[model samples]
Target chain A: MSKVKKNVWWLVFSLLFLLVLTVAISDQYYLLVSFLFLIGTMVPLYSRFEKKKIQSREIVFLAVLGAIAAASRVLFFAIPSVQPMTFVVIVSGMVLGSEGGFMIGATGALVSNMFLGQGPWTPWQMFSWSMIGLIAGLLKDSALLKNMRSRLLFGFVMGFLFGWVINLWSVIAYIHPLSWLAFIQAYIASFYFDLAHALSNVFFLWLFSSSWIKVMRRFQKKYGLLD
Target chain B: MHTVLNDVHPITSFCYYIGVMILSMMFLHPVFLIGELFLFILYNICQHNGAKMKQMFKGAWFFIGVIVIVNPLLNHQGTHHLFYIGRNPITLEAIIYGGLLALSFCCLMFIFLSYNLVITSHKFLYLFSRISPQLALLTMITMRFVPLFIRRLTTIKAIQKTRGIQMDSGNIKTRARNGMHLVQILLVCSLEEALQTADSMEARGYGVKKRSSYLRYHMEKRDIFSLILGAIILGICIYGKLKGFGDLQIYPSLGSFGLKGIEDVMLLILTLLFTGYPLILEGREWLWWRWQK
Candidate 1:
């Protein structure tokens, strides 16, 4: 087979291996193992295949960003304000591109939850934050999202969207006595946190918009990425 | 932290989760809820992780507020009048009932928090590595890609804005249209990434042979003991629930029975212990570390 086909088969096989690994562990272990493998193996694979050049400095920066994202979640519990982590994840995406952004978001949840404790929600948290990173990466190269207002808006929408999507998971995984109504109630109850998160995103965007642009420009120039 | 307790066996933890879930759904015991809350608080204090406890409370405040506001308005059935608000009559029973509901929620949260402490993603994957590779792979990829997708969307939005497209200060319809445009971009990018991943995995021969894990979780005697203890607690709780120990009664006369005296308290404590085991273990570990130091 050609090199491309061989690569495709390898990718398919690895994914299958991941599935087997997930089943081997019990539920609690399943989430922990899956997350580690994703960060440890799948991420590097993507980086290698894409031939992405990540400097040591970039890795450190992403790790620190992950730490801050995790810290912000802990802070969210105390302040009862907007979600600073969502904005942080978005910013990480803006600066680091898709894979870096993803690692930051996923790792942030993984590490932070260690402190706060875990549950079924950990996977959901990982999924939600990762989605935020993915969205940011996709928009990194768009023509229309380069302005300050648009970035701020994107951040705001993400805040709300993040809440909505996670609530969808809660509706499915959490067995509420009220059934369907429980989902609605959970969504409604979560509105304030979502609003706080959305507002925080707006603030962060306003506070750091220019610096972000400069950083993105420097990253693109330095690495010739997402061109 | 004797690693034995700090690190609960995955099977034991999973069983505990199922037990708590079953209790929440069927039993609806006020004692169980209250006991769970007390244990969670005690465990939090013991861990000295004030920061995490604070975060859990803070993150949950909005939801608590919403429940406080909506429960009375929607529930509407109760006796023993408390007061009158507008045209609505607030009852003593509804308030007490709402409090119970909130407690129940906190119990669930505590269970989840404990689970998080004991279980890591790596262990989760290890347990399931041999069962079904396809599902495991899909799950792993999904977890891996979600954040990547979100990150890409953010950058794409920024790039679009730089090209002179304004997304803010628009009508709802306009904002939504812009949002859809971003989503479309993400969908396309993700598809490409998925294909690339597929190619990479195929080349590596990922599923061509049996896979071996880098990290191994050995099930020792403690693991068996923990599992047995978890089973006993779960069995008791199930037996109690089946015997109608804590069933809620709501009808012509609003009252509940089945949870009374020592058995009630014991059941409550057990439920809380099961839910908060991780936190308790973490707390014990911290204490032991402090002593050793």
Candidate 2:
């Protein structure tokens, strides 16, 4: 119970930290603030993960899946910003549950970027991937997610969301004194890439959704992991 | 593995990574960023021995080149009128800012490349284990899995080729579908093994007690020296930034990047030296090697 309480406070503290960060980003400390905001989001997840006495195999499982998620990018290396990472994340969430999804997605982005090159986009990628996983996990049993078409549609939408999430760094850190019009223009320019990412995701999920979900679900039950 | 970088302790390398990351973002001025970029290019070339540097350029040249051209087009705010492009007006400030952006990104990209070279997966995991053992272990798993999965994917593709389900041939749709089918087979085949993996964990003491990492890095004198240097420079940069010395205000009108006073010059020099530490060290090492020969 105390562990859970400690986790909850971590949530509150991170939120407060984020609030302070937003104010700082608007002021002269934008660079520092931007960094802290990234750390703030990640800390809570770490604290929560620590609270649970998770076993080694579960950790290994999450790591393997995360690695798979990172390697998934290599398959789509030919295409600009198109990959099945998002699809895999959704399946992990739907079958293995929320934390499982979050771990794989966040870890995937974090480690892959370690190889491809880490930048200002690191924090945003971590946050966005984990959030996508968390949302999928929360709605794992929902009828919307249970519906095949809706799940595929969700993956498609999330693909665009991932692109937008990356673009946020440019919005806050790069563009000085924030102009909405320029922000919109940046989005407009990257629309094609985002569209390709979204469409490719829809294709992946449409074809392999059942098998992927079955694999994840069967593993979850047989091993009694992340229940 | 150029000069002293490879031999530097992992902790020092990690500190260097952190310091470089923050400094690149904090110092928005072009002069500082350009110098930093130059150092990175030099350091990268030194580390990779010129061969991989060409590949890095091949991959990154397009985006870096685009930044210099695109930023001026997208952002048109400055007093110094450079020229007219079509109907839109271009300004020196926008161009300069664009150049700074490009240079800073170059510095960042190079920093990470060096980071990958310096801090291996074992080092990264070592650091992670101290902070949060669970996450560190997970990262270890991830690091291991990436190479394993890639190898497995290739083998699966090879086997599937024997069965006549083509992977590389045919149209994009057919090729993509074939790839997905191969991935599906891989996933299902691995599911049973995943259970065994979990079973093995249960047999071994997984969450039995508080986990820890295998302590590999022992802090030496050089490690401590690097740590002190890293902290000092990071502190100075942060202090200078907060005091408005390194601030490049460009919202309403562009601020002067020119060294107005000795203090400004000192601040600039401080930042330049910190960022250029690798460049200076590598230069000295190269000269030393030549002299010895």
Which consecutive 10 residues in model 2 chain B have the weakest lDDT in total?
B208-217
Tens digits of per-residue lDDT for model 2, B169-256: 8998888888878877766665556557867877886567655446656788867876787688778778877887865766557877
- Extract clashing residue pairs from model 2: none
Backbone clash count, each prediction separately:
104, 0
Interface C-alpha root-mean-square deviation, candidates in order: 12.1, 2.4
lDDT of 1: 0.61
Among all windows of 10 consecutive residues in model 2 chain A, the one with the lowest summed lDDT is A170-179
RMSD of 2: 3.3
lDDT of 2 by residue, A74-106 (tens): 667767877878877877888777778888888
Model 2: how far residue B213 lies from native, Å: 5.0
